[model samples]
Target: MTTGALPTQTLPELPRHDHGGCINKAIQIAETLCNDRGVRLTPIRRKVLELVWESHRAVKAYDLLDRIKPLETSAKPATVYRALDFLIEQGLIHRVESLNAFIGCNCSDHQHELLLLICNRCQEVEERPALEVMNAVAKEIAEAGFHVHRKAIEIHGLCAQCAALELVR
Candidate 1:
């Protein structure tokens, strides 16, 4: 419950980086978490998670269904949605409400409040532990006697890499 604001930060995968490591790390974490929680990460669910982690960009449900169909020929809209719902419940992924899309949660090893920085140009989504901002919002909710089941702040803009590219143009 530390309430310190984070300084402005850049997307960790920006510019140029080896993204294959990202996929591997995320999958490994998901497997460990599932085993620790005694929850079964079924084949379909694992596939959906892999597809979502294919990039940092937010992915829509239908898009996920489409991508998964080739691998999981039995996949349907309902199948994808169910897997998504489970992933969100387990804190393995997040729904970007404004964008109506989903993004993999990098901090799935622990529970935390997050802020999503979405780049309009590159369609990449970065997750941040914006503790101070979430604390403020919690205080406001308490004052209003409101109960929040879930909370995430999403801000859309150009990520550092995209902004630098803009300058060059």
Candidate 2:
């Protein structure tokens, strides 16, 4: 709805719930929504997202394999990898390329290009759909006659709590 209109709410300074409970609710909600949309909530996909969501830090796929059950020969790397792809496609999670891992995105609805602010200390990641830089970049691209499909913006820095700790020292 923000194609041209101002945002309905100021972006949250942080998410709105107990971390543990919020994540659990997000997964359950995603499952039910997927079911209603006639999408398959396969066991492997659920398990993978759960494993990623449990961590405040980005978690590697191999690490997730360890957290979930070890795979049998019948299920090769592609099985879990494909599930991760689907999860990302659905906007239920984000991939941190620097870490070569994934993190759960707790958005209740679909959004445009993602902008992530990652805390180095706590490793907590927050996703926002800010269009400031995105719109500028898109305008530049259009001037050059290039089309942009998908974009993800990641800015790594200390969060509020971590910044306060630094000030005390």
Candidate 3:
């Protein structure tokens, strides 16, 4: 992470509330986005998207394959990978490079940069739109005569719950 180029504005911490509605809302958004983009949300892709939204935590590719295998007897690694790739390309999900996993995109704003926060203790992941951060980085990159095609920041730390637990001790 570059210091001088990054924006200083802080975003509100993700809420530790029920995420059932979040999952449902994400699915609806995915459907609309895919349709608008003239992409097919095939059964495999839809299921994979659902699995990715199963939690607020990032899910590894193999883990997703294992889960889907039981349902589809002929499921293969390539099948799940392709579905994951499509979802990512559609902005319905994000790939956490550091974790080699995928998580549902919590933001609906198109073309906005995302910042992922991972809680080490609980493995909870939060996705946020950090436009200011993106702009600052873009400016720096442009100054260097380079264009940023895409960028995402992944930060690992304890969430409020886990941090509070540590404080009590």
Best by TM-score: 1
Candidate 1 local lDDT, 1-169, one digit each (tens): 2122222242234465788899888888899999999999999899999999988888888879878888888888898899999999888989988888899976865555778898876678899888788889889999999988887788888888878877987
Question: Distance from true position, residue 52, model 3, in Å?
Answer: 0.5
Question: What is the TM-score of each predicted model, taking all chains together?
Answer: 0.87, 0.77, 0.85
Instruction: Report the alpha-carbon TM-score of model 3 versus the true structure.
Output: 0.85
Runs of candidate 3 with Cα error greater than 4 angstroms are: 1-17
lDDT of 2 at 116: 78
RMSD of 2: 9.6
Cα lDDT tens digits for candidate 2, 11-49: 224444577887788788778778877888787888777
Sort every candidate by TM-score, greatest first. Answer: 1, 3, 2
Off by over 4 Å in 1: 1-14
Best of the two (2, 3) by TM-score:
3
Per-model clash counts, in order, read 0, 0, 0
lDDT of 3 at 132: 85
lDDT of each: 0.82, 0.72, 0.79
> Lowest summed-lDDT stretch of 10 residues in model 3?
1-10
Residue-wise C-alpha lDDT for candidate 3, range 1-169, written one tens digit per residue:
2221112133224456677898889989988888888889999999998999987877888889888999887878998899988998888899887777888885777574778888766666777777788789779988999876678888888777868966987
Order of quality (lDDT): 1, 3, 2
